[model samples]
Target: MPITLTIPDGLLSPTAQAEAFAALTEAVLEVSGLNGNAFMTSNVVGSINVLPREHVLVAGKPAQAAFVELKLPEIALATPEAKRTFIEKATDVVERAAGGRLQRDHIWSNIVYAPDGAWGIAGRSYDNGDLISAITGSAA
Candidate 1:
């Protein structure tokens, strides 16, 4: 799993940007119920891109909007309810990190899933069962 956050530069103070990233990561793990899983935690990683304001768009026009995107295999965050929770929590994280600089409407979050077996890490491919096994420590 990978969580990517994109925020327009200057939308949040420099320090807030860092906090926002951490919060976003936590939100994903928390929603997926994998906070204490070492392998899951280590492999679920991504980046925060603070781009120039002109680089971000809302409805095809430039705006001070933030985007949170999570990419995972179909089996991860597989339920509608799970994805909804992650979105809500992620949106909240963006709001708090913005310190009111941005409103709820300015934040957009999405979860996208690759087909089973499309996800891999460190040169090893993993199918749905492989991923679940790795996550549960039930297989090597």
Candidate 2:
């Protein structure tokens, strides 16, 4: 199944967006047992949001806040093990990116596993469905 991973705002620095994407691509490849070539071809999409004048009560005073959000299409891997492994690695990358600079409580995410038929195709005829089935099973 393709697993969609959603990363909430404030989990990473806007400047580090590229780095974060690279990290995710690397992590997914590592867990999926795929080479750098395969990882590079994977369809990866991301977005960032900046809230202006967001206020929060701090020590009985209002404070401004900012954050970023990321979304990854549930990439199909070679197996279920690979899927789980990728998720673990991805989570680690997210946590490391967040570090202690952002409030952990503000971080939000969701993983949605869908059937292979539901997986979207992107790029020039490059789809991970076959690879994902090889690892996760036909249902994926």
Candidate 3:
């Protein structure tokens, strides 16, 4: 029951991305009732995508978009109800981070549970260095 949350491109700035990352982490803790340290200790991974040439017009103005995709273990999906619960909770976190400018439609997500633990990590690394810098707060 691994869930992946994909953020839209250019939706967040560097500072905003950092804040969103922290906010998302907090949201997960609140919804899952998991300890912060323990949750951080887990192998949760995230990637951010920035489309420099990508912009959307809102109120006749151009705005940048950013995409963030997160992958978590399927252990959260023990039952159908659990899967629904996770999706609902996870999407809530994402929506909050997006500040109403983004929604489920703006992003794409996938949840897969496999006994052999096959979630393509390398395949999902399409964000280049922008997202990595946002996640790590280092120079890209």
lDDT of each: 0.87, 0.46, 0.46
Model 1 TM-score relative to the real fold: 0.93
C-alpha RMSD for every candidate: 1.8, 7.1, 10.5
TM-scores for all candidates: the values are 0.93, 0.50, 0.50
In order, how many clashes per candidate? 0, 11, 13
* Residue lDDT tens for model 2, 1-140: 12233333444567565565567666654654444443333444444443332343335454322222223335645366765666556656655665655454443433444444444455323235554543344223
Candidate 3, run of 10 with poorest lDDT: 131-140
Better of 1 and 3 by lDDT: 1
Task: For candidate 1, list the clashing residue pairs, or say none.
Answer: none
Write model 3 residue lDDT over 42-111, tens digit each, in one string.
4354544444443443345544333333354444334666546555655665666667777565443345
- In model 3, the runs with Cα more than 4 Å from the true position are 1-5, 26-33, 36-40, 52-74, 117-140
User: What tens-digit string does per-residue lDDT give for candidate 1 at 1-140?
Assistant: 78888988899887887888788778878988888788888887888888999999988888989999999899888888998899999999999988878879999998899898888799988999988889899323
RMSD of 2: 7.1
